[model samples]
Target: MTIAGSDSGGGAGIQADLRTFAFHCVHGASVLTCITAQNTQGVTRVDAMSPEAVTAQFEAVMIDMRVGAIKTGMLLNQEIIKTVAKKLVAFGCGNVVVDPVMVSRAGAQLLDDDAVKTIREQLIPLAAITTPNRYEAQILADMEIHTLEDMQTAAQKIYKLGARSVLVKGGGFTNELKGIDVWFDGDRLEVLQTEVIDTPHTHGTGCTLSAAIAANLALGKPHFQAVQDAKNYVTEALKYSLAIGQGQGPVGHFYPLLNRG
Candidate 1:
C-alpha cells in the first residue's frame, strides 16, 4: 500500500506509486494525506488532510486488507507524520519503505524543520529501507555530498538514524556520477549505478524508484537485490520518459505495456 499525497497531474506521489505497483503485478492500495494542484511546471496549491482523516484511511485499510509491504511519500506535516508512525507501530506493520521527501533535487526545502525532525526521530527508525535523494540525504546526514565517497559516508551516517538500510541517490550529480547511488546497511556499503538516460523528463523518478523497491519486497526479493532491481527498472523507465508538459515530464511507468503495442 502507498500512503502519499495526490498529484492531480498524475506524474508523482500516489499516481506514480500505484502505477509502479501495478507494473510489478502487485495490487495497489492508497491512503491520501493531501492533494496538490501541480503539473510539470510546479505545484501551485496544496491542501493537507487532517490527522483524523489520515488515521481513518489508515485504519480502514489495515483492518481488512493483508498488506504485503508499505511505502510512504509526501507526508505533509508533523502531526500526520506522528500519526502514521504511531499507527504503523500499533499494527506491527513491517517491510516499510520510507522515501524522505524533505528536499527536491533543485535544493528546495519541501518539509519544515520540525517535520523533518519528526521523520528523523519517528518514521525512519521504522523503515526497512529509507531512500533519500542527494539533497534529502544531506539534510538527514548533515553533510554535503560532492563525490561518491561522500555519498557512501552520508549513507552510513543515515543508517545510524535507525533505518535497516539507507540508499543515498546521486541523481543530482553531473557527468560520471549521474545515476549512481550509495547503499549502506549496518554491515555492507556499496555503490549502485546504471547508464544515465539523457532527458529532461525525469519527474517522479524518486517516487517511482522507492515504490519499485516496495513492490519488489512484496514479491519477496531480498533487500540489496531489491534496490538493484529497482535501479534497473527506473533506468528503463527513464528510457521511455514522457514529454507531455511544458516543463519536466515523468518516467514511463507502463513501459512494458507500451512496448507490447
Candidate 2:
C-alpha cells in the first residue's frame, strides 16, 4: 500500500509510487492522507484529509487486500502519523518502507515540524526500512550530512532511534559527486553508490525509490538486494527522464519501454 498525498502534477507522491510499483510489475494500492495542488514549479495549496477519513481508507484497503509490503509518504500532521502507526500495528503489517517525506522537491515543508518527533518515536521503529534524503536525514538525526561518511553516521543514529534499518539518500547534497546511499541494519553498514545523472527531471525520486523498494520486497527479494535493485531502477529512470513541465520534470518511470524501442 502507498500511504501518501496526491500530487496533481503526477510527478510525485501517490502518483509516483503507483507508477514505480507498476514499473516493477507489482500491484499498486494507495491510501491518500492529503491532497496538494502542485506542479513542477512548487506546491500552491495543501488539503489534509480528516483523521477519520484516513483511518477508514486504510481499513477499507486492509480488510480486502493482502498487501505484501507497504510504503508511506507525506503524512502531514502528528495526528495522521499516530493514526497510521496504530493502524499498521493493528493490521500486523510487515515489510514497511517509510519514506520520511519532510519536504517537497521545491523545498516546501510537506510534513509539520511537530509531527517529526512523533514519526521518529512512533513510526520509525515499525519500519523494515526508512528512506530519507539528505535534508530529511539531517532533520531526523539532528546533524549535518555532507559526505558518504556523514550518511553512514546518520544511518547509524537513526537506527539507534528505533528504525530496524535506515537508508540515507545522498541526492540533495551539493558535493557534485556520485549519488551515494548508505544503509545500516543495526549490525553492518553498506554503501550503494551511483553516478548522479545531470537532469532536472528528478521531481519524484525519493517517492519512486522507496516504492520500488517496497515492490521488490513484495516480490520476495532480500532487504539489501531490494535496495540495490531499486537504486539501479531509479538511476535508469533518471537517465531516461522526460522534460515535462517548466520546472523540474519527472523521471521516465517506464525506462524499460525505451529499451524495447
Query: Best candidate per TM-score, number?
Result: 1
Q: Where is the poorest 10-residue window by lDDT in model 1?
A: 172-181
126-212 per-residue lDDT for model 1 (tens digits): 999999999999989999888888899999999999999999999987757889999999999998888889999999999999999
What TM-score would every model get versus the actual structure?
0.98, 0.96
Candidate whose lDDT is highest: 1
Stretches of model 1 off by over 4 angstroms after superposition: none
What residue pairs are clashing in model 1?
Answer: none
Q: What is the C-alpha lDDT of each candidate?
A: 0.94, 0.89
Q: List the candidate 2 regions with Cα displacement exceeding 4 Å.
A: 104-109, 176-178
Indicate the residue-level lDDT of 76 in model 2. 90
User: Alpha-carbon error at 153 in model 1, in Å?
Assistant: 0.7
